[model samples]
Target: MATKEIRSWAYDELIRSPFALPQGMLGRLAGRLMLWLNDPGELVTLIGKADSVLEVGCGPGGLLRNIQAKRVCGIDPSPDMLRQAARHNRGRDVELRLGTASDTGCPDGGFDVVVSVNNVAMWPDLEAGIHELRRVTRPRGRLLIAWHSATGRSPIARKNALPEEKLARIDHALGEPTRRYELKNLTVLEKHCQR
Candidate 1:
């Protein structure tokens, strides 16, 4: 199978269905590993006291748990992942919902910032997803999208890395990023909403 096809299959079979992702235990373990691998606190710098924040494809709500904001919302396609996130953030003021990156089911201009970490590769329609994120963000609000870097030379990193073409498309769609940097094994891109 082609690389794109494999990625599509992996996303459909594993990411979209968190319960069946190498079985439940392994899936949970992977989510925990992602939490450890990516520092959710790194996102706070870009947020900078934003009153409202939204995270798309927030698997297990790991990043959402770390963000300090007046209102925080997380959305993911997998009900199993949402259940896990709810359990993890039981006492936190987080709104977890079942939704996709391309269609978040949020109001237009609803949030001060929108973030998606390690989630872009799984977006079935990457362009539409970017537009959806822009739609939900208020003008001049920040948007941060990040993923594990292929430069990490780890199997997981290589598997999760966004294709070069996809990355270019995202950069073009967002215009010029205000900041692009690497944090440990992750690559981040930040931009302000112009619409």
Candidate 2:
């Protein structure tokens, strides 16, 4: 399904309802796991210095807090995730936008770094998400997509080696190199202005 539909479903499934969404020790544990999975210093190194950073699927915005960018914003499909991120950003200079990687509300070339953490593996259309990442990121800006790959398989990637179809989609989407780290299929994509 398209991102719009997925966003709508996410909004309904997570928020706007009278009942409460899932939360508790497990959620907290999972949040911590996500934080550990996406190392902070590595992100700092990747970005060099934080400027206008945008994080896609920033659940709870834990990683966003670590990066001291001039201006930081986040986009996620789920309202619950947005709410969680907002709560995490309480008293902080961070903007949480309700959207998806496929289409964020920000203007083009507005971000110095476009990073997606603990997401993308389950993206309904990964290519669309990558295109959006390429769109918002500034010239020569970086795009880091991190997913929990227990066996280094993407969980969806099955292995660091993406199949021809997936590679084709990524190639056609970002129009640049998407490298996978050793033992971690958390794909890192870079985009340049004149690519």
Candidate 3:
């Protein structure tokens, strides 16, 4: 997603509909259930002993909580989203930062794992955000990103639903075959993540 397109989607689609599916009532329930069911796979894999975790664009801290790490931090560019996260994670160990992914205030090698769901492609400077994530992650750390493609939304709440033109912009920006990635490893994008 390009800057304007992603920004618009975040404000219009994401802000308006944080929970539920992008399809309909059944989709919403299925999405909700999937969130819980998929928790162990997404959360557990991003943690390790002696690891400090950082989550970019963490919404409501659900992923943050599910990770089950004592040392964890999160950042989201939207104040509204941060407020929601604060309300949910108040008095918890999670440190929620109010900022964008591209310029998160963190020191080099500050974290052992950096995780994001449904946000990497949305970044205006995708590589910059990736750079930041890599910088914060110590050697041997991992970065995980998840996204919901145009096929459909499991939770069909109102979505900004990018216009075909916007979609084209994103397709052009990211290059061809923006396919789903395997969790096992990244034989691809290794140049971006290597220490």
Q: Which pairs clash inside model 3?
A: 20-155, 21-154, 21-155, 21-156, 21-157, 22-155, 22-156, 23-156, 118-146
Q: Candidate 1's residue-wise lDDT over 1-195, tens digit each?
A: 111121441144534434223126656776666656666665667567889999988887777887888999999876657877898898999999988878899999999999987768666677788889989999999888887877754677676777676677778877775577766566778888887
Q: Over the full model, what C-alpha lDDT does candidate 2 score relative to the true structure?
A: 0.62
* TM-score of each predicted structure versus truth: 0.81, 0.69, 0.61
Residue 77 local lDDT, model 1: 74
From the highest lDDT down, the ranking of the candidates is 1, 2, 3
Question: What does each candidate score in C-alpha RMSD?
Answer: 4.5, 6.5, 8.0
Over 4 Å off, model 3: 1-41, 46-50, 149-193
TM-score: the better of candidates 1 and 3: 1
CA-lDDT, candidates in order: 0.75, 0.62, 0.55
Clashes of 1: 0
Tens digits of per-residue lDDT, candidate 3, 1-195, equal 111224433233432233321223433343345345334353354344545878887755666765666688988765545555676677788888876677889889887777666565466666566667777877766665544434333332114233445444433433343433433211112112346
